[model samples]
Target chain A: MEALLEVRELSLRFGGITALSQIGLAVAEGETLAVIGPNGSGKTSLFNCITSIYRPTSGAISFRGEPLTRHSPDEVTRLGIARTFQNLRLFHNMSVLDNLMVGRHLHFRKNLLAAVLRLRGEETRHRRRCEEIVEFLNLEPVRKTRAGDCPYGVQKRVELGRALATEPRLLLLDEPVSGLTQEEKEEFAYWIHEIRGRFGITILLVEHDLRVASRLAGRMVALDHGVKIAEGTPAAVQRHPDVIKAYLGE
Target chain B: MDLVESYAEDLRFARRPAARVLLGLLLAALAVFPWVAAEHLVFLATLIALYSIGVIGQNLLIGYTGQISFGQAGFLAIGAFAFGHLRIWGAPFALALLGAGALAAVAGVFVGFPSLRLKGPYLSIATLGFGVAVYQVFVNWEVLSGGRSGLAIASLQPMFGLSGTRWTYYVYVLLLTGFTLAAYNIVSSFIGRAFVAIRDSDIAAEVNGVSLTRYKLLAFAISSFYTGVHGALYAQILGHIEPQIFNVLESITLFVAVIIGGVASIEGSILGAVFVTLVPKVFANFREMVPVVYGVTILLVLIFEPLGLFGRWLKTRLYFQLWPFR
Candidate 1:
């Protein structure tokens, strides 16, 4: 498999505290990689750094063989990288469909003048793209429902829909099923697989749920105290003493 | 199927009677304001309308887009002085106004460029400093602004070379109508949606490919453009251009009106402007106790209804409209 993302000696620090230290990782194209860790194990820190929310103190991140540094989150997104937040961050005031439409903003071809004037081709194309996304996400029925008013499971689904709407080649999900119920978690696992199968996009998921990782991830890495202690197939990582110690109690 | 449904939804919004009636009343009011009011009051109304235009820009930035700007007065200054000076140099007042808007928009981009690196209160401070610095420049530049004393504005020319208070009355009303209509168009458009999205969750907006910098700067630019037009209108109406009119207090008053009226609301902008404008005049009899009355009213409003008077009025209107269901 071709490498879609490469992180080399990625180090991030906040004042005197080192959040991530010399951690290197690579994601292959069309692969689902999961990062599992205890709370405060730097899983979220790494995600934030990769997404440019937290600029790394020192490191090199390359996407599709090109360097990714000194770029804002918005700039990184335009390069085809999209992510979902740990907590659902859907626009609360916007309807589910409008939330999804925001993801397609990069794909909007018309300028402000065209949008303001309701130009012929621009309006039609803009409307069509919005409709296509709503259908693709199975969000037609709840399209007009405000995102904040949705159930936890549905909100997660809407976040997924939003990420997918960006048409990114790489999708990063941070605990996509964190607060979901048992049934909802199962449904989310199924959709994770479905997304990979349907889109052939690379996915990097940060999840604490072992069952979720086992169900969908092709490979897994375990981190503890800001260090990657073990990495391999899910079964191998589960068997690793350090990984088990970090999770089950030392 | 989704596209078809969306089109149906769009049609529903277009046909909504509440939106239509509200808009109709706004237009009717703006059209009739000058005809009923005295000459001095008409001038005050023009000032309010002009200030509302700037408030419309602030609403887009502070209210809808969730970008904090203290430099709105800076943009107003750019517009006012540019128009004032250009008109003094024998340029057509209309063209000067257009030029002022263009210049302010370019300056808005200059200021907004540094904003991508900042957020929240930091951005607000940066913008505030920018406004103050611009005001200082206008004041110190004696040749352009006549320094602290200010410069005189030429009277507005009417259709077919008419002049005087009556002619200016129609012009102010027409300009106010045009500004309000433009603001209305923006409030209901895709651009408006983008700003609201950015306001609510900028990270989510970006992950979905809403470029934060592009939209932020666009908000600033478009907002400055409106403010510039307002400044031009102001200069013409007052027949005077001074840095004092675009000071920090004026900026805060405009912002206060929007907040007191309601953020992200066109009606709120107008209401706030009108209430702020006329309330002082109405309280002239109370003289010494005016501040007490004003302060008490503001505190009560802020405590009981945080969304401002217009927000409360909107809730009441909506309640009546959906009476049984609500």
Candidate 2:
């Protein structure tokens, strides 16, 4: 498989406290890679660096062979990467459709003048694109609802829809199954396969549920204290004594 | 993934129906003001509408994008003085209006650059300083702005050879109505949703592919451009221009109007504009008790209706609908 992303000895620090310490990773095109760790184990921190939310203190990140530098989060997104926030940061006041439509901001080609006039078939095209995205997410039923009033599971689904709207080559999921129940996790695990199977998009997930990650991901990378301790197929990594010790509290 | 999908659904549920009807009625009333209003009332209405344009500008920056701006009046002053000076040089009214808007947009960019590095009260104070500096320029530059004494603007030429105060009043009213409608459409459009997204969470907006620098600056420039057009309109309607017309207090007044009406609500601005403009007249009726009346009303609005009249009305209506049947 062709390499879609690469991170070499990436390190991130906030003042004197090191959050991500010389961690290295690479993800192949259309592949699913799971990063599993306990709370404060640099899972989200690694995501922040990959998404350019927290600029790495030392190390290199490349997407599709292009070096990633001090670019804004949106810039990183424009380069075919999109991510969902762990805390759920949906635009609460806007309509359901509008939230997804905002994900397509990069697709807009017209200026304020053209937008105001609704000129040259712009409105029609814009409307068509919005409808396509809404349908893709199965959001037609509540396309006009406000984002703030939804249940936890559905809100998480909206975040995925938003990420998918970016037309990303690589989608980052930060604890997608963290707050869900076992049944909900099972449903989410099913959608994980669907996202990859239907969209042919690469996914790099950071999850805490070992069983879910092992089931959903073809391979897994384990981290403890901001360092990768093990990485391989789920069964191989599970039998590795370190992985067992971390999981079983040995 | 689930979080994102559910938020999308919630957003669909947020649009209210009664608000749209109220907005439509307000726009219709404003559109037909000149026919029934007295000359002085027409004059006052023109002023109110022009100021509403400034408030709308503030709303774009602070209400939509969550950036506090105290320099919108400075942009308004720039527009007023620029258009007035251009008119003196024999520029057509429309050209003068566009020129003022363009200049204000450039100024907006300058002000907004520093803002990308600042937030909260720091941003407010920086903009406040801009407003004060602009006022000083108008005070000192007698050649262009007529200094402290100010400059006189010629009466607005009537459309299609029509001439009269009534005709001009109608013209101003219609123009303002058009602008209000445009502003309404903008706030409801996709880009407008981006602004709200930026306001709610800049990081989230960026992750969703909204370029922060571009969108925020666009908000400032567009907001300032509208204020510039408003300034030109005010100059034409009043036939006078002065620094005092766009002072720091003017900035406060615009903000108060936005907050009292509803921060991000277009209809709220119109209601707030009318209230701010007419409330003084309410005090006028009480003669010596004018200040007292003004104070009491302001206090009551602040204490009893924190979201202003609009919030109170929404709450009351909701109460009636949900109350355990009569």
- Under CAPRI classification, how is model 1 graded? medium
Question: Against the unseen true structure, what C-alpha lDDT does each candidate score?
Answer: 0.80, 0.79
TM-score to native of every candidate shown? 0.90, 0.89
What ranges in model 1 sit over 4 Å off? A120-124, B1-14, B21-29, B32-41, B160-163, B187-190, B285-298, B324-326
Worst 10 residues of 1 chain B by lDDT: B1-10
Poorest stretch of ten by lDDT in candidate 1 chain A: A115-124
Q: So what's the TM-score on candidate 2?
A: 0.89
lDDT of 2 by residue, B244-265 (tens): 8888876776777777776776
**Candidate 1 structure quality by residue, lDDT tens digits, B101-160:** 988899998898877888899998999999899988888888767776798987876674
Number of the top-ranking candidate, with lDDT as the measure: 1
